[model samples]
Target: MKRFLVAGALASTLLLAGCASGTGGLTTGSVDSISAVEPGMDSGMVTAEGLKTNADGSVASDASGSVSTDVSRSVIKTASVSVAVDHPLEVAPELATIAANAGGYVQDSSNSPASEYQSESIYVTLRIPADKFDAATAEVLALGTFVSSSQSESDVTLQVTDVDARIASLTTSVDRLTALMANATNTADLLAAESALAQRQAELDSLVSQRDYLSNQVDLATLSVSVIATTDAAPTSQSFWDGLSQGWSALVNAGSVFVVALGFLLPWLAILAVIAFAALVIIWLSIRASRRRHESSTPEE
Candidate 1:
């Protein structure tokens, strides 16, 4: 527990505080350029018709009107929570509700039977909004004793920016390809332009889908919560032999006490010993006299 506290303190001091930093956003590429590529020129043009690549090094008079934009990266927010509750079955749902009320949802749950010396344990993963993560954790701790907990935040800002930039660049490529395909007089040129346009369009679609996924991750922070409940087990009763063993143990203990008392009464022990010896001697003499009298009478008869 002390180790956990120390780690937590260090993390708090060293880790970044905010979900975002410096208007923290995805990294993005700058617009490279927008230039007209003539039929004989080796340049690229993004236009409304289709993607256009020049055969040679010349600029088309109409290519000057188009502009270029770069895609940016996406940033994601993440965290985790783990705790052992005294009553998992009873407390887990309640805790889940608390988390829900705090703008979180249970992601998953696990359960196991009671072990030889422990109660049933249940674990649940709770995902909450980034802003409510702290409150959610506190409410869970209130459900029962806290065994352990931890939290972390990762910077996906650069990744997000990169995906966005890719999407923008692809979208621009698709537009240019479409423009060139429309203007092509040769079937070969038209086919090549259409193929390029399709490729760029597909890439754009993929990037946009990636962007949406990243957006969701950033919007919702994920936390994993685990709960364990203490359960009552059947008590084991002592058997007949067990009772006998206990009785013997008590007798042995009493004998030890008696020996100890004798040690403390050494003077009294000597007096008791002398008295017992005198009593035995008196009984012996009386028996001997009786026997002698009976024998004397028999001889006279």
Candidate 2:
């Protein structure tokens, strides 16, 4: 009987311990469930298991492994390139075609014809998709001699994250306000909820606009290209009218240079004139004094 009681007591103790462990696990799971659905969590924070949305509003899993972490980075890219081409006008059209093929567009362009003295040149600004920036730039660079190139990037990740957070918070606020308005009992409560909703909606709209603008800057890479014709590409001959126009322009330019030179020399010329006048006056006074001395020495003749 003593053995039986001891065995029973041991079994009861084990049973109690198992029960306690199960209870603890249940409590922990309940807490986790509550936290998972808790309000005000920043859903914009990308995590290893985080899913991203497609443009069509469909949920998609990240397949690029660690690349998803960089998805949140908002970088604005821009480039300025100076290239020497044999024909700038010809290159301008080719550049436009290249941009079009790259799913880009020419934002602005200026093509100047080759003159008798000046070489033909073109300035074009393109807006290409960020994904195609490198390829587009490479193609553009290959179109002509690479004179110089520079690129710039700005990280707006923090700003984008902040705006997203604010937008989410405001969206929650608006939803709450809308719910309150729906459940409002009195006129005063209804009016107040409406006013709050309006205010929150306005703020949400502004933040969304800002986010969109930032997104556009990240999505489109701006590239400014300057194509200059080489000296060898200059026109070798000119018609009579072309010669006359060139001569006229040269004359005008020469006159402008002459005026500028005269303006620069005017001050020096004035100083020299003053010095010369002073020297002349001194010489004249000296001669007059010498004559007087000679007369005096000549005994008042």
Candidate 3:
């Protein structure tokens, strides 16, 4: 009996963990021949035979161990990318078109015109089908110089399983609570059931919302792209004045930067100058006094 308890606990823990990772949910559930969940049923209610996933992804179960996990979820892929192109404003739409071609669409987008301080930029958020994620990303990266890119993935399989289990538990609980309310002869019990029912309903609604969101995320991958206008290519030809004006600007910018740096260092330089002057005066006085003492000690010459 003790060994059964220990093994059951170990098995349940491992099953829960394996189901949480998306890789094992489908296989784990298949191996367990647990009864199906029906209306007003406890989803996690294990039977006399439930399966546990081993470290090697195999299932192990005996007559004494069973747990129910009927839910499975896919991976959610999200990415953030940045690129530099000749015309950011133009490239934004091209990226949208790429998504459309791949059976996806743009979720959000914004464009900023060029300014004196910075070039034009556009930000876009695209929703692409999971299968088309890589293709769309490659298209985007190819549009211009790939400045930076990052991507991440999330497996909501565990969360879906948890919420489903909770919803099942609450459904049955609500049914029982409703029955109690219907049979309650007193006001207190009736009010208590009503309160519990309301709480359960609220929680159930929230779980449904979460489940829907995860499902959407798993179906469609999200890509956030930032497109910035690349620096202008060096002109093939330039007039003399163009070169002179560019050189003048460069010179003026350098001078201005130098002046700013000098401004910051001026106070420190002044302090050092005063300390050096004082030290020189003191040294001069000490040398003169030493010479007088030497001449006096040498006798009248």
Order the candidates by lDDT, highest first — what do you get? Answer: 2, 3, 1
**How does candidate 2 fare on TM-score?**
0.55
Q: Weakest 10 consecutive residues, lDDT, candidate 1? A: 13-22
Candidate 2, 179-255: lDDT as tens digits: 66666566766676676566557757777888899898899999999999766434557799988998999999999
Clashes of 3: 1
Q: Residue-wise lDDT of candidate 1 within 1-301, one digit each (tens)?
A: 6445433433332121111111223322212222222233233332222233243523344446553333223334455454555556777668678767987678788877677556787777777776777777778777765566676666665556546545654555555566565556667666656665565566566668878877778767776666666323222577899789879999998998899898989989899999999999999999999999999889654
- Where model 2 places Cα greater than 4 Å from the true spot, the runs are 1-71, 115-117, 232-301
Shift of residue 234 alpha carbon in model 1, Å = 22
lDDT at 188 for candidate 2?
64
Who wins the lDDT comparison? Answer: 2
Of 1 and 2, the candidate ahead on TM-score is 2
Residue range 122-236, candidate 3, lDDT tens digits: 9999999999899899999999887889999987666556556656554565566666567666576567557656655665566678778878899899999999877743345
Task: Show model 3 residue runs off by greater than 4 Å.
Answer: 1-73, 183-186, 232-249, 252-301
Cα lDDT, model 1, residue 291: 97
Which ten-residue region of model 3 has the weakest summed lDDT? 22-31
Error of 1 at 273 (Å): 57
